[model samples]
Target: MFQPDIEIIAHTPNPEKVCTAAVKQTYKKMHAKELIKNTSEEEVEKLLTNIAKLGHFSTLEHACFTIAFKDVSVLFEQFLIEHRLASYSAKSRRYVDFSEAGFVIPDYFEDKPEMEEKYRKCMLYLFNSYKNLLELGIAKEDARFVLPYSFKSSIIATMNLRELIHFLYNSIYGHGKEFSEIRKVGGMLLNKMKKLCPTVLRYFDILEHKGNASILASTYESSKSEGVELLWHTPSPDKSIAIAALIKSTNLPTALLKDIKQEEMERIIQSVVRSRRPRELEQVNFTFRINNVTLAILTHITRHRIHSPLIPSLASIEKSSSYVIPKGIKENKEALKIYREAFDRCMEFYRYLKSKNVPKDILAYALQSGNFITIITTMNARELYHFFRLRTCLRAQKEVRNIANNMLYLVRNVAPLTFKNAGPSCYFYGYCTEGKMKCNRFKEVVEHYKAWHLSPTKIPGL
Candidate 1:
């Protein structure tokens, strides 16, 4: 039978009543008396059911469900974690030794003995290579570059009832219906949530997809490309909108935004911004679609949960052609030879496994960490400020640093005043924070972003 090892680890007690009480508080004005005392269970159920029918689900956010996943592939974790506004604690690959770890075998390989053997054999070989790299004095972070996505992993994901319903409705009954594994897990999680808050959970529309596989295949086709491409999906048209929003917050007429020149506007924007006053920048926004980046870089940027990332399955993007050879690796002829050889062997087995009709989910085990992926996300100016400061630091990974630098350059062009202060934390605070790990190039980092702010068009090589 098709089943995934998932359990409801913890959930809010009397979740329906809690949600109903929270919903009631929002509708009525605060009268100092106790609001939730002596409410009947039947009354709570009726109230929540009525709210559900009326399509009011904001109160559902007050209820949360935490679930534990076991014996699942790392690929699944990537997909599940894309549901932002959720808390996740997954076992770390960089720190955890997966040498002796077991993997989840998909039922797709059950009827085919040859493909199943190839999968098991490939996993054993990959794990041995991974362990050998570790034995060769390579760091776990580097050695993990050889690990496959199908490697079994564990994660505890907790989400509010509102997001949980959205995840279920989207993954199980909506766009994700074509993805069998996500559909299966989504169905199981949905059933679990209904048990905790039946009244609130009852209103979700869990309809299955009628689309063909071409719809899903097209996503994978777009996932792999040869170079970095950044497109501003929803850049603000002018500085006026941002200025108007901030002025509105101050209860001032938006017409004032028109009265101020660019120079005065920059001062007004800058005056409100401080290390502690970042929340004021939330009035501005930027959305981007970045293509052809390695999963290593994707892993780092996706940590900024304030934004929503729509990603395709890692299984589809796993290909030898999609692997990125680090610049350092490419500099050494022997190292480059060895790296290419390893990827060739990995893909050779992968292609053979695919030819045998092995499921793509299982085949993802043969993919290297350098595999390519595309990510589309949106972050408000506040989160972008945080992202730039953290990811643009000298201590951060180079690939994402390039990405962060490019993002800052693009945003500055759209709203120069709003993002005038965006850059590394050291640039903003006037001192390096990395201590001994610092690149000791504080002046250089500051000048680099200074050029970005000063430039009229896109900075070359960004």
Candidate 2:
């Protein structure tokens, strides 16, 4: 019976006027400050109306909205975070105790009393197992592996008008249309926008007819795998990076790069990457196929925006025995028994729901935090460097840190020179960034990476 509780916590004051002034500054000689002062209410409305009609929505980016969502399912949370242009802060299952957290009952169960009872029983068992694991001295982070996707979560998200419009459009007419929960949330968001910005909603009809074709459907065929695999990368990534660096640093013609030797390219790559701002590294890109990634750790990777990660839809979640057990839980016999039993019960419930032929979207609620998924992501060299710097640190979550280490190993093999010094901040900058939370194993960590830097061809143990 859970419903998403959404509220607009804050928004730009006089959003229409702000957008109008932003639009005017693009064409008029007056600065934005003067334009805002002189623009009348009627003028603002008329200008925004025209701007919407003209499909010039960049001006809309100036008006931002911050929203809070409560009692929403983790499924919806995943859907919302896919809009990478926005900023989001959600309740962390890792730190928060969810033993008593209520769950969402899909609308399909409203009339089926017996089915609803069964569903409730299953949810209670999962929550009870989670609590029992906590009592058995399991870390909250590990105990959360049994929590289903239906568990309610809270999130605060900020997005500008341009991205908001895109998000709404997708919710109504694109991939989000496949899920009832997403549609309900979308309707609520649209209602909020009507009250907050009536002028802009007047032109919403234009968006309705405009099809959102960004969602693609396809079937992937691949062997079952675990760990990160380098699928593809720019051809001759080292040369690509070196030439880009040369173009930025010198006025030399593009053809002159052909004369550069392998030794010279190495020197150029080392110098550019070691610089304070290595913008040239962006010229090279790498795509990785990461398998057996738990949903809990997936958030860690996706939170690093500025990359494209192709994740499976919630509806695609199926019954599987695949799940992750943290090292700590594995070491405790009592905790390990409870953990395995919890996953077994969840999967057994999933099969029962499958026999009922419930919609896959709702059935996805059976998925637990530790359920394994495969995803493909592409990142530019600059962003990869940033990703490694944060996720390869000793303080990072163990699962994600392992994936990051594997990725570093792969990328270093192909573009050794470009990523010569790529590693944790301490290794890259020669100092730790974690203040009081320092791992205090600086010498050991530095030496570990130093070996990889010196021997890029060797496969290091993850």
Q: What is the C-alpha lDDT profile of model 2 across 1-462, one tens digit per residue?
A: 657899999999988888989888988999888999998989877988887788888889999999999998888988899899999998777778888888888888999999899889988898999999999888888898888989888899999998998898888777788788998898899998988778787777684456654456653333288789999999999998888888888868999886789899988988888887888888888999999888888888888888999988768666578788998899999889888998999888899989999998888899998988889999999999999998899888888888998999999988878888889988999999999989999988889889878976654433
lDDT of 2: 0.86
Error of 2 at 379 (Å): 0.0
For each candidate, the alpha-carbon lDDT, in order, equals 0.70, 0.86
lDDT of 2 at 356: 91
lDDT (tens digit, per residue) of candidate 1 on 258-298? 56566666666776567366555675567787877776567
Please tell me which predicted candidate would have the highest TM-score against the true structure.
2
lDDT of 1: 0.70
Best by lDDT: 2
